[model samples]
Target: MPTVSDFIIERIREWGVTRVFGFPGDGIGAFDGALGRAERHDGGLEYIRPTHEEICALMATAHAKFTGEVGVCIATSSPGAFHLLNGLYDAQMDNQPVVAIVGQQGLASVGTFNQQESNLERVFADVAAYVQTITTPEQAEAVIDIAFRTAIARHQPTVVILPHDVQAMDAVTPGAEHWVSRSSVAAASAAITPPTEAIAHAAEIINAGEKVTFLVGAGATGATDEVLEAARLAGAGIITALRGKDVVPSDIPYHTQQLGLLGSLPSLHQIKRCDTIVLLGTNYPYGEFLPATGQARGIQVDIIPEHLGVRYPTELNLWGDVKATLTALIPLLRAKEDLGWQEKIAEEMRGWEREMLAQTEVTFETGANPRKVIHELNQRLPENAIVTADAGTTADWFGHHIRLRRGMRGDLSGRLATMLAAMPYAVAAKFAYSDRTVVCTIGDGAFQMLGMNELITVKKYLDRWENGRFIVVVMHNDDLAQVSWEMRTEDGNPLWEGSQDVQSVDYAGWAELLGFRGIRLHDDASVGAAMDEAFAHDGVTLIDAYVSKNVPPLPPHITVEYAKNTAKALLRGDPSELAVIRDSAAALVTEQVERVKGALHLGGRDDDGPR
Candidate 1:
């Protein structure tokens, strides 16, 4: 008879899972043996082994984010299971579907102080939508089915603990008597659509507004045309959250890039001045950046009812598929004759674009400006590139730069806001879409934490990627840049050397050691040439750019409170205070100079300069 592990593997394949990320250990030796047999027989399943179990879990979440599929990860019991929590929680917070399978000490060993045995159900209680342990062969299929279904329906991670003995048992069918159940693979959930009345009410609110703005988030995926149609009818501008960067192409005239701390000036201007706002499938958490309560009449739409009307108070909340709901509402919205508001939005966006370009021209005495690095790289981004970023000033640069065409894909840990996930995310993106070019940016602090080892994993799979155009950019600043700035800006304190300062690593050299092309970038003049060389390479490459840590990631609209705190921080004797003031002054002056240049170029048929 075939072992239970064989049945489980077959069941997973039946569920349409083609890849699994994991690490090996004796606790999962039975399942590992089954995998070996499957491979021998050409089971069409691919197994990826990462340097650590944490990476396995992170890659699983990333796979789901990139492909919109249920990601699967496997690991051993005890310590391995413990390592999965960070990435599992990342999935839980970001609302991605992931399934984690872990091995356990045999069922008989439990409750006897057995080594490597603990109550896994309790351990996974907080992070999983569904957690189960198979006691017999008869229970395996039904439980596995439930785990997948629950993860998909809820967009959450689920767990399955397979004891050693249970894995070794022979596969058997459930009997007609005595608490036996059976299940088969099926669809996870039905698509949701709002009631006709709700859509009509939402349309009424938008029709009544004079100056309307739309906020789109990740939930707006596949609804780009509908969003554009609704905005065109209402004479509104569109603002995307960071997660929704690729939902709409950046070239659209009225599409304000992003809205939040890492947002553009036009996004802030439009949000502050608009008389009405429509929140479309975006759960943007920064409430302060949104219009004040009652400042604008609001309408919200989302597939998940729980996400509706939470970020901003809405006059109407419609629970439905974004594309379907927008399609329904589009017919009801009237085409506004006056294009004045959209024209103003377009003009402001032009000004912001010029001001942004001025920032990239800044240079420090010892380090290159990261803004310039990303700015040049953005000019060469492929239309179908898959981009990922870690949490830090890296995100600030990525959010402000890196404009994506419609077909391109990009994401980072949003709600979780975790560091060191960029490399794993890019690796998984390449695995899911091997033909697409994958580019990722990470800060030195995060790169040192886990990325050094993940490079080995990249080397192991270098020969497998169909396109082989993977590039990882590391910002080598020799400091915990984001946290150090946060201390100065948020806490009104100086940058403490004891905690914020860190040793820098030769990221490019490390990449070369792993048989990949590597470039060390420290000057602004070489950014464009370096990017061209890296992108043209056939295999993987790493760019280690030494960037200035003193360049502040300024908020789009600086408030009095923020300015006051920054002054206090500077007065507190920050070590990089002089560089901070110099860069800030130079950037502000340059932006003003560019704005003066943009004034004459706007409000006409002058498309003379690059947008």
Candidate 2:
């Protein structure tokens, strides 16, 4: 007779989950045994063991993000399950489909305060779209099926809590036939199409305006062609939220880069100038960057009805799948002939790209410019590279500088905005697509936080990765650079004494100790060679590139509040801070001059200059 654990594994395998990431403990011994039995079979789920439970959750989330498949993770009771919260929240906020299976203490110990006892359901409630605890063997299969279905359909995290005793019980065998066939599963969950009236209303709102801007978000991930077609039909300039950065290729003439704080000047200009804004599959949280309530008419298209008009006041809300809605609306849209506005925005983007290139060209006196390092990495990155960035200044440089090709995929902690996710994301990406190169750009502080220990996990899995390069680029500034910058520039305070500054560690040496190639690059001259070495290596590699902490993540447009704060900070700061600001100012001036020259076709070449 099959045990409850065996039934659960069978259901998961049938649902096409190839791998489960987590740590095993006493509470999950029965489930682990079932996993072992399955692995002996021909095509069974592989259990990936990460050193930390948090990383396990992160890996599962990234796996789903990259493959568009439901990612699964498991953890033991209490502390093990608690550790998965951070990564589970990443999946929840980012809207990735993931299912977390957490083991709980035996039912007998529920009220006795036994070891590792806690209410797993309550712990995961907020981070999951659905949470269920299986008390009996008969409930196991049903709950697992529902969890998987809910996670995939809603594109959110779901949790199934399995107590120790229940997992060990004998499952009530159903009729000899399969419990649920694949055909039944497919029929139960089908794509939703918007009503004709809703689609027509959205079309009317979009057609009414002379200048329309399409803001794509994560919801438009697989509907790139449809989005581009819609943009072309409306004669619109396309701008993506950070989560939707990979939705539209940067090389496309009509597409502007990401919008908001880490956005380009051209995108901000397009947003401000457009008479109408069409939001597709993206609930962009920043309303300040969007057109005001009465200034521009808004049309929002999303799968979830509740999210409609929640971000911006919309005249029409088309609730449906992005691709399906666009497919139906295309015939209704009158093809726009006026390319004048789009052309203007394209020119602005060209100028901004030139400015960015010039900034990347500027070298620091001591260490390598972080922008230059990112630019070089971008140049050499493979067309199909899976890039991940930590939340901080590293993500700032990545969002602005790293251009994604048509086949490339990348993401950061968009809504969660948590640190120490880059490395775990890379590991997950590599596991999902072993044939593709995986690169993670992380800040020094973030790397030290949780990424340092995860390196051993990478080392453990190095041999298992068949055909991919795993590279971790540490933006080493020896401090919490982003927080320090915020303190100085936003709060008008000098760098706090011991709180903001961190002692420098030999990260490359640490990488070497963990059985991976470690390379440290201090200047621009060695950057290319270091990158080449890291990419060419067969096993895992870490590049600890020392960068300047003084260079701020300056936005596309500088505001008056920022200027006043910067002025206050400079006045109150020491001589060193003054010198740093002076150097940065000089670099900015040079970058502006280059931008002007490029715009006028005077000096710099039009093409992306040599790496």
Number of the top candidate by lDDT? 1
- Cα TM-score per model: 0.96, 0.94
lDDT of 2 by residue, 1-611 (tens): 88999888888888888899979988887898888887886546888998889988998988898888888999999999999999999998888889999899999888688899987777888999999988876567668888888898888899998899998899864434555322223414435778888888888887777889999998888999999998888989999888788889878886888887778877887887789999999989988899877878998988877789888888888878898889999989988888887887787788778788888877677578898899889988887888999999988898789999888999988899899999888888888888889899999889988898888887777777887478899999887888877776688877765787667899999999987889999988888999999888877889999988777787877678877787777788633476567656867686668656755663443333311
For model 1, what is the error of residue 97's alpha carbon versus the real structure, in angstroms, after optimal superposition? Answer: 0.6
Model 1 spans > 4 angstroms off: 595-611
**If candidate 2 were superposed on the true structure by all CA atoms, what would the RMSD be?**
4.0
Superposed Cα deviation of residue 437, candidate 2 (Å): 1.1
Candidate 1 lDDT, tens digit per residue, 1-611?
88999999998999889999988887788998899899899864699999989999999999998888889999999999999999999998888889999999999997677999999999999999999999989999889999999888888899999998899999997776678887879955536778889888988899989999999988888888899888999999999989888888888888889987899978987888899999887888988899988889999888777888888878888888789888888999999999888998888787887788889998877599999998998999987998898999989998888889889999998888899999899999999999999998999999888987898998898788899999999998999999987887788898898899879788899999888999999989989989999999988899999988888887776668777877888898988888888877776677667756766566432322222
